[model samples]
Target: MAGAAPILETRDLTIRFGGHVAVDGVSCAFERGTLTAIVGPNGAGKTTYFNLISGQLRASAGAVLLKGAPITRLAAPARARLGLGRAFQLTNLFPNLNVLENVRLAVQARAGTGLDFLSMAARRRDLAARAEACLARVRLAERAHASAAALSHGDQRKLEVAILLALEPDIFMFDEPTAGMSVDEVPVILDLIEAIKREGDKTVLLVEHKMDVVRRLADRVIVLHNGALVADGEPAAVVASPIVQEAYLGIRTAP
Candidate 1:
C-alpha cells in the first residue's frame, strides 16, 4: 500500500495531558495514493492521533511533516490550504440548504471566494460546475435539488463526502464515517467510500470501527493500543496478530 514519497509523516509524535500520555513517541509514514485504516479497542488514541496530525490538538512533542516539509506548526485551516482535509466525527451540514447548495458553499470556500459573489451567476458558473462534479462523484447528482434535511442518513453521509470532495484536498482524514448510520445505511456509506477509493489516486487515512468496512477498504491496517502503536502492516496480517486479537477482539493472547 505504501508507495511514492510519504504524504505525511510523524517523527516520534507525542502528546501528554498532565500525567496521562495520550499519544506516545510514535513515528509513522503515511504514503500518498493509498487508504490506511486505523483501528483498536476504545481509548486507543485513534482520534487523538488525527487531531495531532490535523493540528486540532498541539503535540506535546515531535513534528508532522507533509511531503517531507514540516507542517506540525500549521493550524487546521492553514493545513487545509496545503491539501489536508478532515471530515469531523460529527456531521456538519446546512440542513435548510438543498444538497447542491451545501456542496457549492464548500466549493466556494475552497476557492476563497466570498459568499456575496454567490448572487453573480457568471462568477459562480465555474464553482457551480465544480460542485456538480463533486456531487456526481459522490453519486448524489440526481438529488442535487433536494433539501439536505430531506435526504436519508446514508445520503447525508454521501453529501458530506461531496463537501469534502469540493475541498480538493490531496490527503483526507476520516473519523468514524459510518458512526451514526443505520445498519442498512452502513453498507451504503461504506460502498460510497469504497467507490471513492477506487476512483481516485488520493491518500486517505481513516479511523473506522466497523470491521467489515475496514476489511474491504483498507490497503493496510494500523492498530493502536494504550496510546501507542501496537500493529502496522497489511490488513490481513495485522488483524490476525495475536496482540490485536487480545486487545480488540478479546481473544486473549496466550500468556
Candidate 2:
C-alpha cells in the first residue's frame, strides 16, 4: 500500500451550475498512503470540489484521475468499485441497523456481495472480524450492537468512520468529519483519522474547519478561496500565508 501510485488527482477541475462556478480551476494531487487536508472558509468550494472528485457531481471542466487513469467520466458506484470511499459531511447510515450490521454491509460491498441475501452475515467469519476490527478502531466496539439512531451524535460519527474503514478503500475522502461535535468529541474523531493513516496506510483527504485539527493531522494542506487554491504547503506555512489569512481567517497574522 505504501508504494502504490498516485491515488487521486484533479487537473484544472471546475464545476458550474448554470452560470455559477462553484469550483474553478482547482488542480491538486493526492498521493497514496498520505493524509491531506483541504481547508477553506464557507462558500470556498470545498464541498463542491469533494463532490466532483467523488463523482456525486460532474465537473464542468477538467478531469479527475484515479491512479493516473481518468475517472471523471465514471459514476460514484463505479468509482467505489475502483477503491474510492467517501464519507459525507452529514452522517449517512442505516438508522435501523445495528452498528455491526451496518459495518458488515460495507465490508460486503467491498467483497462484491450482499451478506443479507444469499449468506447469513453473522456466520461470515471474515466479514464479522473486519467489521468488529473497524468498530474497535473507532472506539465503537462496545456499542457494536446498538442501533445507529439510538447512539449519541459523536458515536454516530464514529460509526460513520467505522463503516468507511470497513470498505478498506485505497483513497478515503471525508467531508467535515468533525462537524457539530462537542469540543471533547472532536479529538475522538481525530484519533480515529490518525488510526486510519497509521494502521491502514489509507490515503485521506479531509475538508475541515478546525485549524487545530488540520494542523495536527495533515501532512499537506490546501487552502481555497473563491473556488481556487490560494495556498498549498506545510500546515504552518500555509496558515501563515497572507492569502490564506485574508480569505479564511478574516485577519492577517504576522508570520
Candidate 3:
C-alpha cells in the first residue's frame, strides 16, 4: 500500500431529500488499507451518508474526494472505476444467475471489457479465474455453481461482498453486511471482513447496527445521531463516551 493516498474523504458533506436533511455537514476520511465502522441507531443517516459517498445520491452540499481530488460529480460506475465499491444492506445479488456467473459479471464489468454471451462467458478464462478468486476469498468456492437464490441468507451476503471484491476497489463500503444473517452466520461475515482487512489492500467503511461486530473489527468508530456525527474515536473510547451512550442507550443515571 506504499504511495497510496487516503482513498476517500468527505468535506463538510450534507444531503437532503425534499427539504429534509439526512446527512448534515458531515466530514470524515477513510484511509487506504484500514477498517473503520459507522454505528448509530435508526434514522441516524448511516445509509444516506453511504449513498452520498458512493454516488447513488447527490450531495446537496459539500465535496466528496477520491485521492484528494473532487469526485462529487462522478456517477456510481465512474466512482467504481476510480476504485470505490459498495455492498448494500439489502442483498443485491442477481437471483436468477448462478454464483459464478454473478461474480463473473461483476469482474467483467469492472474490467471494462465488451460483453460476452452466456455460452462463451465460461470461456473468457480470465474473468472466470478472477471470479473464482473472489468467491474463494469469501469461502464460497464450494457453492460456485448454485443459483444465488438457493444460498442461505448468510451466503448471499458473502456473495455480495465477493462480487464487490471482484471490482478490485481501493475502498470497500459495506452497509450492514450481516443484516439478515443467522447467529451462526455472524462469525462467517466477521471473518470475511477480517480477511479483507488483513489481506486486501482495500480501505473498508462499514455501517453496522451490531455493537459486537463494531467493537471487534473497527479501528476507528464514528457514531451518528439525528443526522450528525456525535462521536468519532477509538472504538472503546467512543462507545464509553457519555454522548454516544446517551444518544443510543438513553442512560440517565450514573452506572
Which stretch of 10 consecutive residues in model 2 shows the poorest summed lDDT?
113-122
Give lDDT for model 2.
0.88
Residues 75-120, candidate 2, lDDT per residue (tens digit)?
9989988988889888889999999999998998998876358667
Residue 201 displacement in candidate 3 (angstroms)? 3.7
Candidate 2 deviant stretches above 4 angstroms: 1-5, 252-255
Q: Where is model 1 more than 4 Å wrong at Cα?
A: 1-4, 95-97, 115-123, 142-152
Q: After superposition, how far is residue 137 of candidate 2 from its true place, in Å?
A: 1.3
TM-score of 1: 0.87
RMSD per model, one decimal: 2.7, 2.7, 2.6
User: How many residue pairs clash (N, CA or C atoms closer than 3 angstroms) in each of the candidate models, in the order given?
Assistant: 0, 0, 0
Flag the better candidate by lDDT, 1 or 3: 3
Q: Cα miss at 157, model 1 (Å)?
A: 2.1
Q: Write down the worst ten-residue block by lDDT for model 1.
A: 114-123
Query: What lDDT would each prediction earn against the true structure?
Result: 0.86, 0.88, 0.88
lDDT of 1 at 6: 85
